[model samples]
Target: MELYGLVTLVGVFLLLALEPVLARNPLHHPRLDRWCNNIGLAFTNELIRFFLPLALALVAVDGPWQAFNASSLGLLWGALLAFIIMDFSLYWVHRCSHELRWLWRLHRTHHSDLDMDVTTSFRHHPGEVGLKLVLMSGFIGLLGFTPAHLLTYVLLHRCFALWSHSNIRLPEGLERQLAKVLVTPRVHQIHHSAWQPETDSNYGQILTLWDRLFKTYLSPDQVPCPARFGLEDFRSAEDQRLSALFAQPIR
Candidate 1:
């Protein structure tokens, strides 16, 4: 667990610290908004996720021992299985975050950003992270995942998610070819598209197959080119102001 924390902390720090300077595009959100979400909320959510599971899983699980049991599939296979499950779980969670009105209250802060960048990856609300933590706790416990296995899968998917959100777009042919296996920027950018159809499609965060399987997949060529990005209802200026933006009502 200590190493897990270290891995997450170091990875997040490097990405959040140097991505702006490394990427060619200018950082879109103000430094304050970026820090507030990436550093402030990240720390807060980390603490919440850490503690919440201890309590929530106590009565919730059949037994903690059961949760720690090894998968007969072996570590490598267990890791792969965990990765697929986590990605599928997150796909539904993200889709519901958009479709459900109340859930959108906690999730909308992320979309409020008009500018797409790496730091934008951490702009989610603490409430949303809390909900995810609860869901993750249930998922691991019910599925009998050891902490090591779960962390491996979580780290893999999260790294892909951060990479997908990056301002550094991939070479043209690369994204199309890779979308056959991994999630690519072009596929994910469509998820952030301002248009309704594109915005609702492409919910798969790590694997491209989930969207295709579930009928939400829209190829980059097929989705309309959004004239702009961000939530359909959000204005660029007001969305920059963190306090006012989070407090805005969903229309």
Candidate 2:
């Protein structure tokens, strides 16, 4: 858990510094309120995370269904399976966040960002965070997942989340190959497209397998990279305020 938090923060800071040099579409040299607001939101979430019990802190369940047994495999294999299962869970959770209107309200705070950058990855609503926590915890418990499995998965997930949301462009050929298995930045940029149909697709977090299987994927070649992001109506200056973000879901 400590490692998870450390990796997330470090990845964000590293990306923050590196983004300008590597940015596909260079944003303002010194970002204004938006960047700070996103960071502020992330800090609040870190506090929320601190108070909430860690993912592995759950009491073991004795249900008939067991998703994976960590003891059955070596640690490396267990972590690999754990991430695959967790990514699958994320694919559904993320898809639901867009497909369901009420849930979309909680999710829009993230998409509401007019810009797509590393910080945008941390712009989730508190309610959305809590919702993910509950749903993901249930999945973990059902599987009887181990601490080691979860710890490894969280670090990996967060690192990829930051990478996927980054504005830095990867080589098209390399990204094309990666998108075959993993969700690349190009793939995720399509997911953030302001167009509703495009926004609703590419819900995979780590792996492209689920999106491809479920047919929710919009090919990067089709939509094009560096697509316009965020909801059209939600782009007003007032709408970007930190206070407005908290009230957004209910409003």
Best by lDDT: 2
Lowest-sum lDDT 10-residue window in model 2: 53-62
Error of 1 at 137 (Å): 1.0
Residue 49 lDDT in candidate 2: 63
Backbone collisions counted per model: 0, 0
Q: Residue-wise lDDT of candidate 2 within 28-49, one digit each (tens)? A: 3336788887887888777766
lDDT of candidate 2 at residue 126, scale 0 to 100:
88
Residue-by-residue lDDT tens digits, candidate 1, 1-251:
46647766676667666655655245544666655545555566668866786565454545654645446677887777878888899889999988998987888777766767666677777878888888877767777665555667666766776777766656668777898877776677777776767778888888888889999998876764455667757765655565664465443
Clashes of 2: 0
**Residue 54 of model 2: what lDDT?**
55
| Best model number under TM-score | 2
Off by over 4 Å in 1: 1-38, 50-73, 236-238, 245-251
| TM, every model | 0.81, 0.90
lDDT scores of the candidates, listed in order: 0.71, 0.80
